[model samples]
Target: MPETPPRARALETDTIRRLPKVLLHDHLDGGVRPGTVLELSHEQGYAALPAEDVDALSAWFAQAADSGSLARYLETFAHTVGVTQTAAALTRVARECVLDLAADGVVYAEVRYAPEQHLEGGLSLDEVVRAVNQGLREGEEEMTALAGPDRGQAAPAGPIRVRAILTAMRHAARSREIAELAVRHREAEVCGFDIAGAEDGFPPTRHLAAFEFLRQENSHFTIHAGEAFGLPSIWEAVQLCGAERLGHGIRIVDDITVDGRPVTDDLASAIARSRTEPEAFALGPLAGYVRDRRIALEMCPSSNVQTGAAPSIEKHAITLLTQLMFRVTLNTDNRLMSATSMSREAQLLVDRAGWTWTDLRRVTVNAMKSAFLPFDERLRIIEDVLKPAYDD
Candidate 1:
């Protein structure tokens, strides 16, 4: 028999679903509704999907993502990214992404996708941004309309306020161009920049010029690191490139040790049971720096498990890190692939890690603080919306 994890102030499933959320690391291309994917595929004449039926297709996505087959998991994206080449498809998907998050109780979100990936249909980068931005704006409007007329501009503050993060593929050479595009459209739905792909061989420093340009322009960016790779990936993202927030910075946990053993739940209990810190909970240089600096870790448990960054949701390092008070925030890296949402992510943590409402609030605030929004506005929402809703 296993010992049950202790809880503090956990909320019920319904209550957790009602809590407001802030999403900082979500992919636009990866979150399309399964039915929408099928519709777009049929409309666009891309017939490569494994299943035409939405339910079967949705199940296929879940199984591939959960089956430990990285190649099969990635093939799901080929279908999604394949159908989203047209501007109309991009706009619809972007709009639906916003609406879905809003309906899921996300008050703020930064959805990211590679503009380069949508150019197969001859749409320029600017046009890609334009279509996505238009969809986002329209989505905001439709969601607002769905809410009662009493909420005016306050609607966005409650329903959802979305911003687009322009992503550049890591294995490609167009990072500098994408960085420029991100900066050029900063005033639009575009809010920041990122580079994401396999982190094994392609270190973030490969796009140093792009990062340098963002620095020169005084912009914000995040790098995908420490997911499939290790500390070296995170080190370069933070120390080398100045990433404001780490996308899946889970491997930072690798730096912590206690009595020569890593800090898992079992090993950590030994240190805690001993009631001594002389050799207990030692933070390696990287983990110490990250914990001290409060760099937010975008811990996508389901996606991490899919990619082998973690073994299972219950044994995820996020549980250990959260207990140790690292800046752990939950995100649904790809909803369609992971069959997850912000609410589901929180509820899973509640179940697997014995997280309380307080823990949920802390991570929500963590993501809000690390959001690309201006600090004052971020603080405003934390004060006006999130804190009060949690109190209720």
Candidate 2:
């Protein structure tokens, strides 16, 4: 891989932070503010935090999640989820998530969390959804008010439209219930349904009934696949379970062979070579289907690296998939756990992966296109907000 050019290297972090972005796969619990977590823990009397100081807790969460194992990476969420058992905690976290994304120039985001996981405070699933939606709405309003009338023109921090994606834990049996909850709250900030958890033994087919119910209700959904697991997980999510977009679908690279051999090393070079020597690369049936159908792949660089899904940011499959013209969208899966934001993700891609502004814009556009938003709203953001921001 070539070094990032001097001009690109000289790109200011503020410039990247100011770029309008669309996020499709952020987690609500996974993005709690460290200070918020500490305060909430104190308020809730939950004393399980490994660190008392805010900075220490923040560092602890980052370090714990950086352990190259998805399962271990997920364990850090217990603290975030632990404190967010009540309506207020959930609302605060959700609201802060929107504001943080807005501050980072995320124009649109679909933040997801499993309602069932937050019911320990005696709140029902419906109540959990309502609380989160309330927070998201409040956050959007606050962001818009802060941006003022000039908004995108005068303020680099523009208002962000954040919706909720109700998730069902794959290891749990509440998928159908969550899907119904998502459909019920569709007009009230909830946009879609998803099944997320360890993707190893529990296939998305386990939640087939939920997907079928969602399809019958004319609802949208995405499945967590191809992150911790492999191609079979992705294949089942798309072919069998009908995922609209793939959460961390970086594993689709498994279906592509470069030079008639499996991609084993230097994925950056192989992808670059494939671009110039198209004949040297071949996509398997599943890969072709994903690309041909334009199923969006929500690829999170930092999270993927931390989860051992990809070797590193520079060698991540997102760049390869982008080169192959797959529907690829960059994301920050867990802002707290991965210690990332949309800008940070883009910065890593630009600095480490040799991505240009055009690449960032293309993926941002792809994200907005793939979002579970109304068609007219999606088109409006693409035409009015995203394109103009990047074109500037």
Candidate 3:
């Protein structure tokens, strides 16, 4: 029997989980707990769930999300959004979102959702934002309290801070309205803005008004691009609309071409090739600008595979981007739908792409620097929190 390739190596499954992580592109409604979904359906008198058993319900969602179509994958959210129509449901889900990420060792996260979707229960848009913010506040408090003495050192050091990103669905027409809402709450809990939905025909340009509004307000925003689509979509998102970061920008790999495969499959040298030579690789204008400009690619590995953006973890473009030294950040786009975490995404890279701990630390730092928070705050967390955790 032949020896397995180095790309086949995997760290201890728990090792990645112990590292402090940051999340940038998580969705609020899409990450509802399966058990909670069942309970919420019962509480809200919404009886449309396909499965009653907890494991079966989870399996059903995973299977539904496995469809290679982005539109089909998005359809799985109807049940989650259906039950989250009320303030109470929204609050509970947001609270759980914070606590769950804290337990997974995430120190910072920006969770996003569309306010327009939650208005089906007759709540005003302002009311929806306030409810979600209140839940985030309470969830942060709850996580701190739980970490007091019972969990001891198992708890993540320092408090887990969360901020909200107001998202407008691209297939809809209320982006300008949502941009105003985000600005209104900017000083409150809302940290930034975003536009999300299927990307085939509904380009980010459809929400240009919103992007311009945010830009004038001196606010930050991320656009969902280059996942189900290609480099053209990414170009529109970054060049035309001025996105600060790209959500699931895995397709940026389309802009990159290699002269020759690395003689060794290890990730370290692959990254060295990116920093050293132009002749060894070809970066199209779009990719070169994205790299040179420090525009972060919010790469979601497992979710990309689930959405058919990439065929498998082994073949995902993140490996190439990391090797090419592009500004890459790992994320779990929809924790429930993709059934992944930041740690799991990093671990998959280690197991399938031969990523090293240095690669993990670099990506984590890339995420911290690209965080939507103010510069001083991002610096504080990086210098005080992240460096200390990973430096050891």
Candidate 4:
């Protein structure tokens, strides 16, 4: 819970953009390549595309996903989902996703997807998981080979590492099954469980049995909460369901007040006390708990603006969230939909938030610290990968 000092250099001016980063909340179905979507959709004879050409199709996705409603924003996934039903399609997309993140300078990433959605091609959950894993491994190998001798010597590591998080749709009744699947495939490819979908009515508490099962097995899980709803959803994600982290916990601001606007004190003792007391916040219990626990927020600024979570880039809460010492990590919630990259996300934070290099380093390290992986592994990424990259 210690707050780092801010620096004068902007995020783009910072050395950390070249520094390795860890991504924990990205979605596979949401990160597909538009060109791949065109080819795969054609191969499968799926006809839901807004445009046939790859370039036009890519623009079409961006335009369609720009709708403010989260539901309508999510509708673009049907085109992506339709193309990804087959194992070959899934592998290709997964591989390209890894390559894309690597190109964006991510040292480690965990991409989540619901296996049930990909079963439309008659493939079982395990098969889909293996195919995606194979794709990741293949992509990492290719990246390593392409790193070249000079860049390899300059870069202090092998190719980027990726893990898969098996997501179960919130509206579906298969949470327990998916939780078991995640635990069952822990060594193979699966690293954790997540419940992704609309967050308004389909709260995390609906999957108590699954969360309980995961807790019993000592498995890691992050809940998609507070993106489209208010503090109630975030409260349940943590208090009722025991989520280790909240994906896009943007709505926690609804509880705070800063200069008559929403902003929690960066270092308030009362807010800090809520880490364990759970009910100590005079402003909002949810905000206090999140702040005290040091729970990381996987914030995707561009996607938030596109979905109307915020009105614009400059006015986004992420700027204030970082300043408040919240454990905030920049992420690409849906790369295809937002037409974004992790580097682009960082650059946008710099351009709009006036974040310094130190700010970028601090947030990236916060992400490494908050990763669902074990502590030692996360530390290794921070000390071995991130530190060297930024220091150089």
RMSD per prediction, one decimal?
A: 5.0, 3.7, 5.2, 5.5
Q: How much is 133 displaced in model 1, in angstroms?
A: 0.6
Which pairs clash inside model 1? none
Q: Which pairs of residues collide in model 4?
A: 258-261
Q: Kindly provide the TM-score of model 4 when superposed on the true structure, using C-alpha atoms.
A: 0.89
lDDT to native, each model = 0.85, 0.89, 0.85, 0.81
What TM-score does model 1 achieve against the real structure? 0.92
Window of ten residues with lowest summed lDDT in model 4: 266-275
RMSD of candidate 1 to true structure, Å: 5.0
lDDT of 3 by residue, 28-140 (tens): 98899999999999988898999997999999998999988899999999999999998988899999999888878888999999999999999999999999998999999
Error of 4 at 211 (Å): 0.2
lDDT for each residue of candidate 2 in 32-131, tens digit (9 for 90 to 100): 9999999999999999999999999999999999999999998998999999999999989999998899989888999999999998889999999999
Model 3 pairs in collision: none
Tens digits of per-residue lDDT for model 1 on 1-392?
Answer: 75332232346666666678999899997899999999998898998999989899999888878866544566678889999998899999999998899878899999999999999999999999999999999999887777766754333334689999999999899999999999999999688999998677899999999999999998989888888888999999999999888999988877887767776546336334333343357788998888889888988988888877787777778767776778888899999999999989988877876667777888999999899999999999999989877665
| Candidate 4 residue-wise lDDT, 93-185, digit = tens | 988998888877788888999998988889998898888888988998888887756674344345788888999999999999999999998
Pick by lDDT: which candidate is best? 2
Model 2 lDDT vs. the true structure?
0.89
lDDT at residue 259 of model 1 (Cα atoms): 66
Candidate 2, 253: how far from true, in Å? 0.6
Reference-based TM-score of each model: 0.92, 0.95, 0.92, 0.89
Error of 3 at 44 (Å): 1.5
